[model samples]
Target: MFPIFNIHNVLLLVLFIISALIFDNFRHVNLEVIKSFLLENIQYIFIFVCQFILWYKTGKTEKAISALSDDIYKLHKTFQTETEKKEKAISALSDDIYRTLETEIKKIKTDILTLGETFKTDAKKAEKDISIFKDDVSKMCETSQNETKKIEKEIKNEIKQIRETFQIKIKTIEKYISILNVNINQIRETFQTGTKKFEKDISALKNDISKIRESGQKHSSQAGSNLSLTTNRISTIQNSGYSDTETLRSDFIALVDQRSKRETRGYFTPMLHALTEEISLSFS
Candidate 1:
């Protein structure tokens, strides 16, 4: 009743044929024929099953291969994107570092140039100041030399004046000494004249005393004749001699006091020496 071309119908027909053949040949055929036929049928069935399984598995494998390829392509895209971003960041950082270094180098160059100019200016100022200092020192030295010369000239003038004053003092002292010598000689002559006159008066008094003694011895009866008159005359002569001696002493003392007052001033040593010599000569 089924179609013979259909797979189910063919499987049922083959099973029925196998059952009929088993039933018919089971008694007649030997065990060897039965085994041969079963082996042949089993081999054909095994081959058909293997072919069917392989066909279905091949389709599944192809679908899995396509999905795996898609996943690999997506992973490759992500990795490329991440690598590009990292490379860009690294390049930007490198550029910033290069720019900063350039700025720093420029600043350093400018600072060096400024410092060099300042140093040059300072050196020029120092040279000018040193020159001014040298000029001032030279001026001071010249002024000092001129001042010293003026001082020396003043000292020389003072010394000359002092020498002239000393010479004047010496001349004055010489004049005083000469005046003292003349006065001393005059006093000496006057003293000698007074001494000689006193000696003569003393001699006359001695003669008169001898004469009075002789007249008294010879003329005892005429005593009042010239006795009192001779006595008065002798007394008068003695008074005159004493007054002259006092006058001579007073004159000598007054002359010495006058010379001392006039000549001694503050220069007494030489004057005292000359006066001592004159006094010694007068005394001798």
Candidate 2:
């Protein structure tokens, strides 16, 4: 009814026709004769049409299924290739990261070792410097002590020499004083004798007495000036802290010799000698 041309429909129509032809002569003929008639007059054209239709539908369906399977296989291959590439990239990145970390760690370790060595070297240098400083200080202290001892010994020797020189000067001064006393006594005795003989030689005795007095005055003044000059020299030497006793003694002796020379050349010495000769002449 719906224009059916399938193999099953054609097959059904052929069976109906064969059944109709066989039933139509069923009372007047045998069954074998009817089947022979159907075989000879059957429509083969319908069977051919049915087989062509079936083959055409099956070929189209197989082509569609094959094409779909090929597309699915291509998609699977692409996904697998992308996955492998991603895994390789990740593996490479991991290796690079590990190598970088290892290099950095090694560099840090080397730096730490170098720093440790530097610190050790600095510590040793500081210790050596401290030892040298201590030695220098010790040497300075020893030298200072030695210098102090030398200065002390020199001062003691100077003091001893000064004392000996002072003693000698004191003895010389005492002797000079004794000689002056004896001369003064001799002068007094001559004056007393001259006074007792006043009428006989008054003018000559007066002249001699005046000359003696003048000489004494001049000698006293000269002695006083020399004593003052010597005192000033001694004071200057003491104030200056002169340490050389031999030099001091030599200067003192030079001063004394100069004074002796001055006295020998002065009027005082000749006047005193003339007075002594006059007294001897008077007695003669």
| C-alpha TM-score for every candidate | 0.39, 0.28
lDDT for each residue of candidate 2 in 163-250, tens digit (9 for 90 to 100): 9999997787677656555654655575565535542444654564565556775688765665566556545543332233233334
Error of 1 at 120 (Å): 20
Per-residue CA lDDT of candidate 1, range 1-284, in tens?
22448654465577678668768868788889878877879978687678557756765686688788888999999999999999999999999999999999999999999999999999999999999999999999999999999999999999999999999988877877777678668767875786687668768867876776788767755656566766787677666656655565566556566666554544544554564454434333
lDDT of candidate 1 at residue 2, scale 0 to 100? 25
Off by over 4 Å in 1: 1-141, 220-227, 242-284
TM-score (C-alpha) between model 1 and the true structure: 0.39
In model 1, what lDDT does residue 11 have?
56
User: lDDT per model, in order?
Assistant: 0.74, 0.67
Q: For this target, which candidate reaches the highest TM-score against the unseen true structure?
A: 1
Clashing pairs in 2: none
Clashes of 1: 0
